[model samples]
Target chain A: MKVVLHIWRQSRPSTSQDFGQDGKMVRYELDDVSADMSFLEMLDILNERLTAKGEEPVAFDHDCREGICGTCSLMINGRPHGPERGTTACQLHMRSFQDGSEIWIEPWRAKSFPVLRDLVVDRGAFDRVVQAGAFISVNTGAAVDANAMPVPKADADKAFDAATCIGCGACVAACKNASAMLFAGAKVSHFLHLPQGQAERDRRVLNLVETMDKEGFGNCTNQYECEAACPKEIPVRVIADMNREYNRARIKS
Target chain B: MNWMLDYWRSSIGGKVTMAITGLLLFGFLVGHLAGNLLLLSGPEAMNEYAAFLKSKGALLWVVRCGLLAVFVLHVITGIRLARENRNARPIAYARPDTIQASLASRSMVFTGLSTLVFVVYHLLHFTVGVTNPEHFTMETSAGGHNVYGMVTASFSVVGIALAYVAFQVVLFFHLAHGVQSLAHTLGLHHERFTPMIKTASVGVAALITGGNIFLVLSVLLGIVEVQS
Candidate 1:
């Protein structure tokens, strides 16, 4: 099948006036794309073609093509991870596209997630936020039995749901304001639902939320765009939970 | 106090502040609209309601001052959040699009600022009576302030009535986003209940805007009029 690709291209030299300091969309036509090929595999084929033609290949991020790793990020046709909902770019197949369709692929857009290369962004800000407080502090001694600390079924389910978040920055990419509340909120709620996370609960919310703000991410306006674009289908309710935790933490502190 | 200041400085804090103040302002609107609806009950009820409010004296001033403080906070925090939001995305998408963001949600800042301008004009026209003093200087036979006469005289003019209706449309946009935002900001959400909340947000906005527009149209269409 034939697919016309308009992919963002940026180099370290940054000499192109059309692409700006970061880069701009460069067109590539691939007539050999197969329906069975995953989105990353399609990119691989494009790169293989570019290599044979002695041209620079389009750059993108993908670790595991299995979709569990949030390393793959792309704004395909203005959507995070293409049109298919609850799936990553690595999981999106060429079958989702028509034979004669034009595909526009760009990097995740956010101030904190600057475009490092073509379709690749530096998501170090998410790392910094996680480093701030997405964990529980515990003295490592003898290993405790997981079942010993029985958690409520509802709470455990909610925690596991939140734990599915892979820190892809799609929430920021999807948000009109580039808000990371959905991402940060999921992190906060993942811990808050556990008894083991109770000791540092207040500190966790405060630090994660503050770090997210300091990273220049915008506040949530309840638009639910993040949820819609989330590959994990993380609910906006996590954000509300984060708000609740932050308020409770504020009052307690 | 220092902690309070710190709380207000956080993004979540700004959100909570906006929610609380926005809800307060919404409450004020509900009351204001209810009072305005008294116009339909004839001149005596509308004017008497105005006089009753005025009769509160110090209590009325207290409420006004509190409302003023809330309004200032809401506007200030809103502007700050919006500026931060703009900065968070220095570079925009080449072909930006939304999967689910409503038109009202996206245009919140514009709608809010427009409503702010409309509010100032509204106060000048009615509350302070500075914009149209001739229409403002009406009185009832019972020696109470003639709010019915003022409202009727103001709305009788097609242009003035249309202007009020225009502002009501802007206010509708603001309220549409705001009412639901308040619930979310306050950390209130349930999977079963959120859909209802979203619907209620629009419903409440429609009711408020509809009531206010209805009053203007009522006067304009001569359903309600100033007593000769």
Candidate 2:
């Protein structure tokens, strides 16, 4: 299959960059490219070719390639992860494209996640947000039995849905406003759903939203672009949940 | 002021106001698009439509005033809500890297302000006949009725035409956020309909912006010449 790859290449984060300027559209013609090969694996072949030619390999981050890790992020053409719903970049297959298709691959362009080298971004901001307490503060001395807590099925389902966030940062990349409310809301709602987390529910929403704001993430304009771009399909309802929780906390304070 | 704050915070009044005003703007966009579509019929059609608007006298003024009130209320309530959200988190997050969001969502306030400026300029240039010099060319038709000649004349100027295009682009961004937010404010942001709303809003904004840009560019390029 012949594929014209328009890949974004950057030497360093400090260097001024443009889509196809600092980045070049490298063309590749290959035979017997498997449809089942993951997008990263396909990239592996491209990198191999570059390495053989004594050229710098295209630098993209992928750890697991199993879609569990959110590292393999790319804006394929105008859509994220090649227009597949509920899937990461690593899970996207070559079958999604025709043989003669022109693929435009670029790193996530958000102010918060500045490019470190090439496709690799400093996603440490997500880690810092989580460290700000995206969990219940519970002691391990007396572990409560699962049956003892007795969470309702509905609340548990909601919590599980919130917990499904893989911290990919795709929501931020997709949103026109660059708002992290969906991500922050997911984190806040995950904890707010259970009795164990109820103790810190108010504090959690307040702290997380404050943290999100301080980190320079934009406010949710309810455009739901985050949800649309989300690989996990996280609902914007979680944002409303966060808003409700924040309002409650404000009153209590 | 305290009462105002309470009203803004206590009930769903703030949310309802945001939704209602947003929907009004939405309605205005439809009317504006309809009015602007007269451009496709050539300058005479557009001008005649504009003159008709002027002849409405007090009724036109009443509609303008109503639109002004809606716009003011929407912007004010939106600002207040954003401020309240900000105040909810006075302290900075200790860990800043845990969440990854977008620039559009982050710079909404800035984009919104730019759009506001564009809106005022738009009204002054076209509606109030205060900004664009060409807008003064409007005159009565042979039937002793005032007809719209100013709009086509205004579009003839390269600077005004370019400004209109730029402002329309800003308007697209504003609508992209505003329309979807309106749905959320009204509690209609279910998963099934949310995407439809977002896509529809973007499409509508694109159409409006594209149509206006095309009209201005056609006029500026002499593709569509205005009548004497």
Candidate 3:
């Protein structure tokens, strides 16, 4: 099968042109495609061709293509990871596309995560947000017995739901205003649910929120775009929970 | 105290004010809508209702002052938050494939501003009688302002009634999203109750707008009258 992909190409950040002015779309025609081939495999084929012609291959972040690492980030066809819901780009197969379709592929677009090259964005902003929120100080010792601390079944399950967030930054990419509230909410809720995460609750919420704002991410407008694009299917309800946490912190010290 | 101030100053802090202020204004809407519905009963009852409010002069003024304060705060916070949101994303998407946000969610500013404009226009047209001076400034036989006479006269005009109803469309959309978003801000989420909340928001928007429109159209079409 054959398909045409309009890939965003940026040699550098400063050299800009066109709408969304960060990058230009460079068209690539691939004649040999297998429906069974994964999307990243197709990209691998393209990179091989580009390298053969001595042209610079597109730069994208990906590792653990099995989808656990949350590294494979691509805004394929005006979406965070193609059209399918709860699926990452690496997991998306060529079978999703029609033979002659012109697919527009771009990077995760955000001021916080600027394009370093082609599709590779500096997602260190996410790390900083996580660092701001994650503050668990416990003495180093042998692991405690599972029965040492008793947690309700509901809380345990909810914590696990939030704990699954792999920090993909898809919520940021999918949002029109690029709000990071969903990402922040997941982290905040993970701590809120556990007995271990209770000591610095107020500071954690305040610091993470302040850090998120400083990172230049937009405020959540209850759009639920982030939840929709999230490969892990993180619920938007976590955001509402985060809002409560922030307010409680404010009413306190 | 510093922490509290900083909390309010945060972007989410500003949203907290927005939610509270919006709910306060919606409370006022219920009272305002109830009072206006008196137009259906003719001049005497409506004028009496107006006098009842005027009788509580000091309390009325206090409520009005509070209303004005909240209104101004809502506008300021909304504008500031909107500007910050815009600043957060300096670059526009070439083809932003929006998935879940509703049309009302995206158009809050435009609709909100239009609602604000209508509010001013409405006050001038009825309260101060500046917009439709001849029809708006009627005097009651009891030596009080003829509130019902003024209201009926203004709504009798086809152009004025239509213009007012058009603003109700803006109000409907604004209230619909505003009410729902307020629930989210307050951390009130129950999957079973969300549909109920959404229905109630729409119902409130409809009831208020529908009540106002019905009163105006009744006067215009002679279903209600200025006469006893």
Candidate 4:
């Protein structure tokens, strides 16, 4: 199959002012793309071709290529990943595109996730938000018995559902406001549903949310774009749960 | 006391503020619509209803003040949040697209501001009687501000009636997105209940729009008229 790609190309900016302004779209025509190839594999082919031609290869982040790592990030054709729901850019196959299609690819757009290079933005804001409180502080000792603290089946399911979040910025990317509420909400709800997460409940909600705001993310307006673009299909209900948790924590404190 | 202030300053706090105020304003809308519906019963009923509200004196003033406070807070917080949201993404998408976001969901600021303008126009036209002083002076047999006379006189002007209809369209979009958002901010969500909540949201929008539009069209079409 043949496809034309318009890819965003830019070198890292020395100052914040030069971030998005320095990038431009560079077009590449690929005639030998295989329908079975993963999106990342297709990129690899493009890179090999660029390398042989003594041109700079496109810079994009990817690891494990299996969609679990949350490293492969791209805004393919204006969507967080691509046209498919519940799928990441790497998991998307070339077969999704029609022959002779023209594709537009760019890095995730957000002030917090500035483009470091072509098609690669810094998502360290997510790590900082997690570090704020998205964890338990249990002592490192012998493993505790799982059944000792019996959790309700419903709570366990909700917790497990939230725990699947891959820390990807797709929610931020897809959101009109670039809000991280869904991501931070999932983290908050993941802990709120279990006994292990009870100790830091109030503190976690306050810290995680405050940190998210400090990182220059926008507030959620209940548009649900984040839920739709989420590669793991995290529900917007987690966000409502997070709101409940935040209000509860505020009142208690 | 300090915690309350702190809560108001946070992001979630901002949304909570908007949600609470929005709910109050929505309540006011329903009440206001119900009051206006008295116009269907004729000038006597509508004017008497207006006189009844005015009869409360101090209580009426208190309710008006409270409604004003809620309206001010809603607009202020909404504008501040929108500015921050715009700055959060300094760079715009080349080919911006939405997957599931409705036009109403995306254009809240525009629709909200349009409604705001319409609100001021409405207050000037009816409450202050500044827009049309001639019709504003229309008196009923009973001594009262003739709200029924004012509405009929205003709707008789085709331009004014059409403008009312257009603003109703804008208000409909704002209310549809806003009512559902209030539920989300208040943590009201369940898969089974969401369908109902959504239906109720759209239903409220449709009802308000339909009722208000019908009132204007009724006067324009002569279904209801000022008694000769």
Give DockQ for candidates 1 onward, in order: 0.71, 0.08, 0.59, 0.82
**Stretches > 4 Å off in candidate 4:** none
What ordering of candidates by TM-score runs from best to worst? 4, 1, 3, 2
After superposition, the stretches of candidate 2 with alpha carbons farther than 4 Å from their true spots are: A15-32, B1-180, B183-228
Q: Which candidate should be chosen as best, given TM-score against the real structure?
A: 4
Candidate 1 is graded, for docking, as medium
Residues A102-209, candidate 4: write the lDDT tens digits.
Answer: 999988888889888999989999999999999999989899987999999999999988999998799999999999999999999899999999999999999999
Q: What is the lDDT of residue A31 in candidate 4?
A: 97
Name the weakest run of 10 consecutive residues (lDDT summed) in model 1 chain B. Answer: B219-228
Docking class of 2: incorrect
lDDT for each of the candidates?
A: 0.89, 0.71, 0.85, 0.91
**Cα RMSD, each candidate:** 2.3, 9.7, 2.3, 1.3
Each prediction's TM-score versus the true structure: 0.96, 0.62, 0.95, 0.98
lDDT of 2 by residue, B1-228 (tens): 674565355323466577688788878887887887777786567667876888899999899899999989888877876675453323221112222333444566777778778888777776566885545645656543222356667778778888888877777777776666666755565657777987887787788778778877877787766644
Clashes of each: 0, 23, 0, 0
Error of 4 at A162 (Å): 0.6
The deviation in Å at residue B186 for candidate 2 is: 7.1
**Any idea what lDDT model 2 has?**
0.71
Candidate 1 Cα outliers beyond 4 Å, as residue runs: A13-22, B142-144
User: Which is the better candidate, 2 or 4, if ranked by TM-score?
Assistant: 4
Per-model B-chain TM-score? 0.97, 0.82, 0.95, 0.97
For model 1, what is the error of residue A201's alpha carbon versus the real structure, in angstroms, after optimal superposition?
A: 0.7
